[model samples]
Target: MLLLALLMGGLQEAGARPNPQALSARIEVREHTARAILFELRVRNDSGHRLTLALGGRPAYNVLVKRPDGTLIWEWQRGQIVQQILEYRSLDPGEELHFEATWKLVDARGRRVPAGEYLVHGVLNLEPPETLVTDSLRVRVAPAKRRRSAK
Candidate 1:
């Protein structure tokens, strides 16, 4: 009975949280401008032996921007045709990989976001059941400026 309970709880908990330490990875989101934001995802091989990472599909990672209320506003993979081919890459001990994407303060439908606070994060699409994600970042978008009319 105890083992059954542990298995049920542990499996659900493991998949619900970001496991950056599992791959010695770090993610950062920063405001490049009031109308743009940047995402940086870094992964390092801290193990002694070469670490092999299986890429689940094309564009192995993604960036997400959402409202403070958890409403998704932008997704890096939206409308992208990601190939469903598996690929592998090896990282030597102490080596690292970096991935980046920028959001232009727009929603999935390509409209400017209103001036407000938003949350952003990065997701690494590894093998099945082993996805990695970065903690959500809080960002603010400034109001758009009006265009000047020519005299």
Candidate 2:
């Protein structure tokens, strides 16, 4: 009975979820101008061995902007075309990969958004083991200044 219990316990431990510290995702935002913001999404491989990631027929990463009240403003994948092919990449230990996009302070409808504080969310989707890592950052957009008419 002791041997049987020990075997079962070993099997259970082997099937447990991967350690959360094996991978990490982070979002960085910087003001490009009074009406423009730059966003960067970074994914890091923290494990000792090389990690393989498969991102299916979609963008490898996604970014979304929302108001403080949680109203969705714009999404990076709204009008993107993703080839119907499986994409894969390998990351060495302590290596990082990044994706970037710039927002012109406009809404999905092309209208300029009001100046205020907004939340930027980013996600890195990995396959094979099917894991999702996410991070967020806050940004402020300054109102555009108007030029006075020449006398």
Candidate 3:
């Protein structure tokens, strides 16, 4: 009976969440009591061998947090990416590392975000030979419900 119950629970849980591998990468979101949203990035190293979060295209792509329309929100310097390469090369089999990229609840133009849904994504871009990896996430912010006016 216990085995059957465990199996049922596992099936239910599997259907409850999205497949982590279906996307290019994964991030864990945490909402703090103060309402700050944390975006934690994690990449998969399936082979557990030396890996590269390589970039491709002209201008020798660097890591970036971009708006949904492809506007640059933030760009990491070449030196920074090189430092990451030095830090994360040759991932151990079955080992994963996490990084954090935080965004205030405003657009790149410094305008307040409306109560709606927006996408958060990462882009690794550069000149030819480097591969481009893009991963996106959906974020939603809603205003607290207002109290009804008493007649």
Candidate 4:
């Protein structure tokens, strides 16, 4: 998993360097559960040009997630997993735009995730969605560990 991340880091760096209006993303997850988890994704306009971003038809921002193998984890575009899209304003050159949202993690049957190791990713739905999905962003989901006392 670390190796994959390393390779992606290099690929993503190259992707973000070329586009003047491109969007770069970094995600930090506070909690992980089948129901939902708190996520703070920082988006920046690394290019030399300033850009405007929107989420759910507003001057806001949202987040999407997928598996490392290119499986669909969750998406705000269809309002499938998450309840609503987090909002944000414009992003200036080299400026940071913090996008916070609660991700609704579910199993194959739409059931909340149990405890386990899963690789969840964040999708940046830029005006012209990013082409480098694999290289864009990746996050790991560490299912909350529960301790049991001996009887």
Candidate 5:
């Protein structure tokens, strides 16, 4: 089990230094079962002022799973159809947002993936057409167990 934490500076102006008092993000990936995995993303507003995120629609954040060689396996928003309407989310000081999703150890096509080590990370959707990416975490998936047949 590996947990990755990332500190992101607040929205900065062109040629301006990053704001230390900005939102921070953390991600964690763990095995929920031999055939499933759990992904979590936590975002906190640590600054004194309220933080606002300009999102496109549902799912303000996304989780990505890929192999060590950078082969894309699964994504949290693969088949999700969200409204194109723009939405703004605000977080007060000391406020946090938590998001979780479960993957059945399957690929985007709903096929079972082989048991092995996979790299995973989280992406935060923001305005200005920029995204915040967290560090990658390595998680292991166990092999599936075969069921016995009754004679």
Candidate 6:
């Protein structure tokens, strides 16, 4: 998993090059149930100065799913409704913010996606300086079990 994370440019070990944004971000597949997959996105302010994020009334972050072949399956932002006002929040050093969502094993068209390995990506989009922080994880969806008929 660590190797795959490295290949996907997701995980960063300690003492690596300091992030220009001074933030740490990561995406994880929290659980996989029969009906849906749960995901968590986290961002932490690691710098000494307070960080202000302007999300522009949309979500502070976005979640995306892609097939193993690199085909996009779903994106959280595509169906979201937001007002046209700027939203801002300040994060003190060592403070963290999180976003969680469940995917119902459906594609962008609302059709059931096939059982397979998919890549989940999270992106923290911030304005003013216009920076983006990203992380990714892989998850597998098992085939649904068949139900037995009444004897």
**Best TM-score goes to which candidate?**
5
Scored by lDDT, model 6 comes in at: 0.67
Alpha-carbon runs more than 4 Å astray in model 6: 1-21, 128-133
Ranking by TM-score: 5, 2, 1, 6, 4, 3
Query: What shift in Å separates residue 34 of candidate 5 from its native position after superposition?
Result: 1.7
Task: Give the per-residue Cα lDDT of candidate 1 at 32.
Answer: 74
Question: Model 2, range 6-107, lDDT digits (tens) per residue?
Answer: 000122243444554666777787447777788888777776777565555556677889999989999877788866555667778788878887888888
Expressed as tens digits, the lDDT of each residue in 30-113 for candidate 1 is 437766778787777655556566656888888889999999989998989999876667777678778889999899999999
- Per-prediction TM-score, please? 0.77, 0.78, 0.50, 0.50, 0.79, 0.76
TM-score of model 3 relative to the true fold? 0.50
Alpha-carbon local distance difference test for all models: 0.70, 0.67, 0.42, 0.49, 0.71, 0.67
> How many backbone clashes does every candidate have?
0, 0, 8, 4, 0, 0
Models, CA RMSD each:
7.7, 8.7, 13.6, 8.7, 4.3, 7.6
Better of 1 and 6 by TM-score: 1
Candidate 3: where are CA atoms >4 Å away?
Answer: 1-24, 32-35, 48-88, 124-134, 144-151
lDDT of 3 at 119: 59
lDDT digits (tens) for residues 15-83 of candidate 4: 233333355566677775645778766666665565544433342345556565666656544543533
Q: What are the per-residue Cα lDDT tens digits for candidate 3 across 7-33?
A: 001222322332223223454565522
RMSD of 4: 8.7
Question: Model 4 residue 52 lDDT?
Answer: 47
Q: After TM-score superposition, what is the CA distance of residue 22 in candidate 1 from its true location, in Å?
A: 4.0
* Residue runs of model 2 more than 4 Å from their true location after superposition: 1-18, 128-133
